[model samples]
Target: LDPNRLPRTIDGLINALTGELDDETLLIIDDAHLIDEQPELRALIERFIMAQPPRLHLILAGWHEPDSPLIATARLRGEALLIETADLLFTSDEAAQLWQQAGKTLPVDFDELMSFSAGWPLALRIALDATNWRSALGLREQKSKPALDDYLEREVFARLPTPLQRCLQRSAGLRWITPDLCAAIDPTFNSSELIAELRRRRLFVEPFGEHGVRFQPLIAAWLSRRAAADPEWVHLHRKAAVYFQQHGDHESALYHQIAAGDPAAVTTFLPLARTLLAERRAEAVLDWMRRLALTGDETPELIEIQAAALHQLNRLEAALATYRRAERAFAASGDRLGQSRCLRGQAAIYLDTVQPAPATDLLRRALKLLPRQCGAERIELLLMQAENWAN
Candidate 1:
């Protein structure tokens, strides 16, 4: 029966499930996060638990550790059993058994191999395939960097629709992408349909909730490489960055902006880092600034922004280094305005570190670099120098 065609009421769901399924029926709902948003469905599940028919069992699987309302309700009524995925991977003996089952002779240090995989089934399986079990003693000696990307490119990306592939690339730009933002990026595409297609392919696109999705770390890394290769797709990244910035998702916004290669994104992200600094979120600010540096195309203005962020985070040495880099880059580009700015930033760093002589030298250099006709910045630099000396 089509659930959508049924009456949109709790009675309809209870009637449908209880009437259609046998008392002995066991239903497994994987990815409960996706279904929880449907209050009617949650209510139906709740009602089933409350009714408590003999031999009826419901199993829910999700990444989140917290219990949902449905899970809590079922547990309260003594009707649900919770099993964590971590418990299912393997014990050392079990891992050895798996290796033995694959017709591999174990090395003396075989336990190390199992520990390295952390009992992840996929990693174990991949290791088994990559190593020659018949000559297992030499397996440890044959340290191979697995071509994980090649495997996914063939197995995963090859199977997705072009639009879904584009969506995945855009998602790589974001730390997280919700369905609404995904819809915004490709207005003509249906998020529901695309998500279903991705799930069917087992592409690591896990539901964040009913309204959002996230990529597994390995998959996110792979998609980022592919996205970097295609400059045309950068616009989708920019769109995601702007959306996240508007919603106050600063880290996510910074990620997408860096991926999109938008200069304006630097402006949007700098203030957030400053706010984080103000709140004593110093470590977080440093992390974001490091990410900004990795983008590898810093303008003098961007470098100054990064230096200021670093200085606020109390990373005085890194701030000085960034200022020096900005100074060199500006001089190479012959951007005198940028050079003057870099000099002033370097002077500030020197002042903060109590290196008054160097600070005075930098200020004098900055005054010279500033166009004689442009007196405003020169005056500001002199005032800053005077204040530094006073301190």
Candidate 2:
């Protein structure tokens, strides 16, 4: 179909297609989910699907399920059948048949081979190629994280041009692609050209909507590892921080800025650190902090983050010491909020040490400095205030 000839409205498009479509017509739309972003278009598609034109084969391929509610209705009514990842799994019978085509008889434990594959077609292919399926089956496992980095690196990423690889690397952390975000990552970004390249190269990038796309997680992980050591990694993160900040995403901005080792990273990271600590995610926060701490220049923000981590481990005295240092830095910088946080931290240590007088004084001072509107912080201060007097 010609681009200019394409209908401007869903009704117009459906009417045109209705006149043209008949038995033996096969319609295919790759990345169909992207086209499903428009409510009107999705509605049209649902009607088209419900009609189920006689002898017409229609395919709407995408990584995700169709966005049409009618598709769900069709499924519930037994008018539509879904062939998903599970159905694509190679059964022992299918595998044996394929092996027979290659003149090999069924081997023992073939079902065991299928079991290890868990219906993943690629895993099955790899196992079938192995001389010993049992050994291959024994080595199979589920990973908490994606384990396809090496395979993708060798088979896909390594083959790309350096500039494209770098582009993908810098953009990996993003959940979706838009012209604005791409431009934010690198001002030289040309959305149409990059999208065209991705499609031509058959990369894992998929259309998210009319003007959006997303990287497959495994591909993103692989690119992240590949670009981890690049000198531009921090600079790229800094750019990302600016973008996120401009877009009103302070939390994400803080993460990228922290990675960039900006002095403000700690101040921004503190509340999140406290939240993670409270959530019992102290270990994960520590791992994140340790990795970010590698630059070896500890700012007040880093100090506070470390202190917060220490507090989670109940290393009271050490946390108190670090908090004091962070407090002085905040006071000197005229950052009342930061100073208030440190004071609260120190007060907690004092109460734990059975020193109520000093703890009470610290809490009172912090209460004056901390914003009254902060619900969590205010609640924390109130609890600590009560505990200080009780002790």
Which ranges of candidate 1 are over 4 A from the true structure? Answer: 1-76, 86-174, 187-210, 222-299, 302-325, 328-337, 364-383
Could you give candidate 2's per-residue lDDT for residues 160-230 as a string of tens digits? 66666766776765656777778877877776677666754547666777877776543444555555556
lDDT of 2 at 67: 51
RMSD (Å) of each candidate, 1 decimal: 11.1, 12.9
Q: Evaluated with lDDT, which candidate comes out highest?
A: 2
TM-scores of the candidates in the order shown: 0.46, 0.44
User: lDDT of each model, Cα atoms only?
Assistant: 0.67, 0.68
**Whole-model lDDT, model 1:** 0.67
- Regions more than 4 Å wrong, model 2: 1-150, 157-176, 186-217, 228-237, 254-288, 294-302, 312-346, 349-391
lDDT of 1 by residue, 1-391 (tens): 5676544454555567766776587667676544434665565556655664455566666543232565676577875665655676777788788879989776565666565555657656666775443223122223442366667777666654578677676555555566678776767667777776566444555677776666665556556666666776688887777777787787777777877767765676667766775786766765776666644245565566567677776788888898788888889889888888878878887787778888888898888888888888878998988988887
